[model samples]
Target: MMRHLLPLLALLAAPAFAKPDADTRAWLARTAELSSDAMEGRDAGSPGHARAIDLVERWFKDARLQPAGEDGSFRQTVPLHEVAVTSAEMRVVAPDGSAVPLKFLHDITPRPATDLPATLGGAMRFAGYCSAKEIGAEAGPALQGKIAVCFGSRRTGRANGAERLAAVTAAGAIALLTIDDVGFLVEPPRWPDAYARSVAHDGVTLPSGLPQFRVNGAALATLIAGSGRLAAAILTDAGLHRDLESFDLPGRFEAKLTTSQRKFTSQQLIGLLPGTDPAKAGEYLLLGAHIDGYGFGEPVNGDALYNGTLDDAAYVALISQLAARRKGKGFARPLLFAAWTAEEKGLLGARWWLQHPTVPKDQLAGVINLDQLRPLFPLKALTLHGLGQNTLADTAKAVAEGLKIGIRPDLEPERNLIRRVDSWPFMEAGIPAVNFIFAFNPRSQEERLYRDWYVRRYHRPQDDMTTPMDLDAAQDFNRFFYLLVETAAHAPETPRLSPKPGT
Candidate 1:
């Protein structure tokens, strides 16, 4: 009787262990609240988004996180502009003076450079992938006063459309054309009406006096007919051998673009956890997640709102949870929690933060970004984007390994996942940054689930609260992320950008 009584007393004296189900249920509750119809998809600058801001601010306040924004508030305002092509006309002239008229949305899509309408024309030049190294020294003179054409894909490395446009525009090109294969469409299927909406971004002037168009295979064939090289042959060679050869086309191109513009403001929510060490507190680690989604768009299956549950709402909740868990805990360096706006609009909010950081830019040690993480399968492995690009990879690997989770490099580099998230802005600003995704073995059912999610739910209305989820997997990942953040914040030395040699 005495021995049994002692055992019971020992159990009672120990601290209560948190049940896994309870934690998962709490997280799901938050996700459901954020993804509910009442949020209206949390579109940036909309009343729904305003409600989201209020909700997150309340959460931060509840967690007792110190306000890190200007004027001792939890909000930072970002000024932006929306640019869209209202109407566009294009004509490709052959050497024989035969003109081919291209239809909008069917043959090509015009991405306006500014809000102004103008007509521009020039001789055509096929610049392959328009890679800076491929273009070489003579490209400046050759591309001048010409419409430079190239393949629009990740085969050109980090230089995507906007980057390529900036390069050619700087080289004096009057216009740019990119050939995109239908198989590489990034967004979900949409009707012609979707093109009527403009894209938003920070109000930065475009690099050059050139407009860019993303044309399909049909339009490419028409533009390259007079060049003696078949568009099909060029595309086939590039696809098969992954090599592109630049050449001069024996024709000219003309475009008349009309655009409309609107200016508006959005807010990024920021909170801080000051470090215990005064010396290291000035230096900070940034953790970020985008809070905006496609407000209301083309409906699918009788649903219209894109709640973005897995896309980012979960991670934002994770940030709030961490702040609550770590309250009053001592740390070497400060932890900055940021909920960015307009990530779907081309990483605009993150970019704005880089330009106008809440903390001094130089003191920023590293950034950990969370975007579009889906845990549909068991958490056996983790995918770390920008792995080996910095010392942070080592820290992430160590934490994952301790938890018996394998760490893998980005498997789908062709998707340009590294540049697509909020971390990219910090990386571009010369700071070490990393983003995460769940990993699965090759040819496994988990892989199938991952692929199916992208096809059926990514950027779609189907990504709402009603979608089936693996809350256990989500809870496990949240634990891993929390450990990773704590490790980085308390490390003796902050993570730095130290790329592997020859990378």
Candidate 2:
């Protein structure tokens, strides 16, 4: 009895362990290589990212995937242009003529405009939520020549950033400053931004002259200090999405801005595995993950590299691992394995590919994008984007159920994350697509870890190899992904978007 009791106690004392298999171990090893500091965070259009592209191409070649890129090569050059803010200075001139300086990158960060002026300023006016619907009549002559200040919130039904920009721009405001919303805890704003930069495809133009800026939420009180309005009260109202009244501030905004521009190119690596069935060979399923990260940035906690391990490097490695496991074998439908670039710079690579697909657009059946697949805790359920909107949902559900993993629709729709990821472009093109997030029970340890990840390491250098990850969870998700790919690719009918009403 003593011997039996001793064994039971030992087992109970030690936590449950799920050992990673050889394949998962290999997958992580590859992830570490891609996200290593030596890769310089793999920023798009950087030398480091070019090196990563080569590595992925080599991996695909080793897996026996045929080149399906430009001119029968596994490389597609994505034309890109970048603008970096080298310097910026802003001041709030009080009615009495005293100026309060705003710290660059601390109190505010300017979005470098395509036609940014050397200097510009105007009287400041609060524009409530700044939505066209919200601003209604006030957006006309009332905002014609002044700078408009708006609250940035992700609360449901609130206009998104683009709509807000259009509303303020159309109102003839010279500039727009959006105060960061601190209420949104799903993904709170990070202060002292790494840098200020804008990237877009070559030849694409933006709304010129109307510069944009983001004000730190903590500094809102300072901006409204002498306006006779209580900052706390206004902030509380904004945080609660309460109706706010537009008002003129006690000061005029003065500013100086400087920027530098450069043009460079990036690569989108695409490899193909032809289908085994002659009939289904005409169709294809695309598997994609971004290979770019934040690259070099202002030092954070004495570190400056944003390795983007789980943000996408790991998932890119997972794709490579999948290729290796297949060893050149084809599914019922062809598989187009794509490693995208410039995703951090606003999904440029994927968007470009959508416009210039290596395979015929009509033959592309579905897209499965891997990004921000945080495996920080146990993988019990998956929060799927595009969950009931298409046939891909059924395949994902079946695959997840067979693995004993629960599947559910996104419960946090207010975040609007679906439109922010790489899969959005494909989904918008009318192709069925899906993305995933590891789900956790509220108020649980897993929830704590998940939320903490966003605050401490989401886009920071802290997301390096040293960051803690649940190996068991990683392995489980890897298995689920591998099976999901197989199940989706082998299904008799290719995935398609669910029919809409009146279609």
Candidate 3:
């Protein structure tokens, strides 16, 4: 009687496979609020941020995932500093007794908001795109003891736009700011300066200094007008291929700034899916996404919240749903499900986790990072974002083709999407991680249809689940993801990471 009951209990206790429904849509829909302007971009340590974390925790519980963080609590406390720039008093002084006062938070907002006694009468240095120019002996002018004013653009399409801001700040520049150089008819809803940046690994390192901050459009515009030579230094037919070396905006301007800032602690949400195969249970597979987004930046369509709708809220739902489905099903290894914190603060959460994982490096298998939900084009084919590096790329291809899904190779690697998602840490550690994405391209008539539809409702205040969500598509992709995981796990031995390109 005891043996018979054991089998029945085991069968009944199995996890439920995720099902797509209005309920699932509703579950995902809540994230928009967390990303909404009211939440102020969900910066790591804000009250609104805590609210988002709470919602994610509730979802994990509802999905039946065992607490993957400390002491049966799904929260892994990651101490972080929440830098808030309460106010700034900055201005420009001309040759004459003319005086112009600049808005502090409006003119500049840094990575770590500062709280100095609201005054920095530093000399002003005019830096053009912050590039080193090649010309006569005096071309490479040095910037010291002065605030360096440079364009926000740096390293092209591969880096987070915040980086150039961060770099200059690190170089001892007292103040930092940027302006729009690209042309996008429909600017980002709230995060006007946001890089639709899908790849790259930055600090994710524990932040050590104040995030030298600056304001968006309004302040930047004021500076440009004062800059005078702004047009020739930045807006010429420089051609995309030629480097803008030596293009310095030569002039002397007096700059000063004053502000108040605050800092706080942030945390990472983590959990685990113990594998069924005992022999390989020690090895691991990781899934992750940054849980924080731009709480607020520029205003969009009369709305000021930079809710990262698809920026990453979609990934949190995707992971929660996937974890609930795969837990104890048939995985043979420990699969770590991580919801990183303060990613926008320079990969604060993920960088920290990579260096301090629960398992050792040798025990790691691979990683899968989800950044946003690609509701457009619906994956007519599986296009591996990073296709040149390893065997995992081939494995992804085989899985997609075996499943009869078309395999469209990465069309433009110049975009360098390989490092775009949170998968960079795993991939950098040689763990063969891959990013699964559904992207929108407006250049093509065919692609534009989806691009227009998806981008229009993608990240704004209007990014709720009420409009045009296709459950069938979501379910289909989830199914594909499930099978891919199964194939990797059920392999006779750990899948080899020595995979070459074109496999």
Candidate 4:
């Protein structure tokens, strides 16, 4: 309802801007300690994440939150496998038999490959992007055992490089060597840094097959420098023309690779607060935040510990505080609090729970997801993550209005936030879910405090609870989130998926 939030910020901010409060400072301290350099980026399958989860589970016990996990434990187990590149060797030789070898992880990344080998000999066809339009007319048994020179658009676009490379592997093509397309510009193109960080950390080894390769744009350009024809010219040629002979050099080749899948496990921390109503005590209100961060580094950014502070530790601390407050108060519906493990690894903890829930998934009314807590843009109007999936948004908006805050739609619908957090698994299992954040739009006092104070302390080592935070606002936001949990749990009528559907 932050109905008057805009004007309120204007009236409340210091004339020249000011500092945050105590609660925020404390929250920041806990946040810093959790995601600090000492913690090494709370990775899913790493010791760092294990310690973080253990600490959280201990705190949950100390808070007197009931044990609400499988059997009598406060933890859930998730299993995973990794497919890594073990050993590899690649070379480009001419008809004259001169060798042109490339480095394995450097000169060309094998890009993820299948678990088989491929050999192609005859005429190498330069397939531009492997697009139907480019290679549509070049159908030939000749392409059956030959190489295909195409340009992978890199990580910046919708062009599924891995998927397309997979087709080459299936086609039994010796190998696929691609370059950057002009559209593959330098903006880094909205890559999935979050998931990528996690997957890279939880790095796996896969089987070998028709592998893929990509060179840096400049190095690729340099590789093409002496060539008389442009890449597109050779790739799109209709006939196996003599002019395109350079790209067809040493048409016969064999590519072999083997990536073995390996197994590993992690734990999810769970605790509960019993319900007040005898009848609905069996029902549950699920609240969650991921305790894990990127475990290991990938090829792109070598940051080992993906110490995720604002990404989620803040939310965990917030949930922990709520548990402390409600432990004695008693909720109408049982409260199931979770600090997930391996969340970065494809929400494995959540997925595991859905497959083996402590309580029947059908009895659950809804889920409240806590991931990022920073007011990224000083939310003028709170944005609903799933647009219109639940009345929870309406309830949240109503609360905001009551608090004189505003409400708005999400900036990016394509992101599908509702499906990205822990709440998503529950929603998929048929429960309502919502993710809320502290936002300051319309340049409110809160928004001002954020830019003037919160941003720098965000995910960095500085996110310590001691760092100056707007404690008052933190209290308000945390309480507001807790209220949502309380209201949904105790309300005479359960929160439901809005008629139109929401998240």
Best by TM-score: 2
Using lDDT, rank the candidates from best to worst: 2, 1, 4, 3
All candidates' TM-scores?
0.76, 0.93, 0.72, 0.71
Report the lDDT of model 4 for residue 241: 23
- Give candidate 3 regions above 4 Å deviation: 1-42, 89-130, 135-137, 141-180, 183-233, 239-263, 296-298, 326-328, 404-417, 439-442, 445-472, 499-503
lDDT of each residue in 212-257, candidate 4, tens digit only: 5555333343334334555455433421221223243332333344
lDDT of 2 by residue, 83-195 (tens): 88889999888888898888888899988777988898998788888999867766556788889889987787787798888898888888988998888887889877888
Per-residue CA lDDT of model 3 for 325-369, tens digit only, reads 654454766677788887766566777767666556687777767
Q: Give the Å shift of residue 187 in candidate 2.
A: 1.5
Q: Model 1 segments beyond 4 Å from truth?
A: 1-20, 87-107, 115-150, 156-175, 182-203, 216-238, 242-258, 277-279, 298-304, 326-332, 497-503
Question: Residue 149: error of model 1 in Å?
Answer: 6.2
Q: Which candidate wins on lDDT?
A: 2
TM-score pick, better of 1 and 4: 1
Determine the backbone clash count of candidate 4: 60
Better of 1 and 4 by lDDT: 1
lDDT of 1 at 20: 45
lDDT of 2 at 220: 77
Judging by TM-score, tell me the better candidate of 3 and 4.
3
Whole-structure CA lDDT of model 1: 0.76
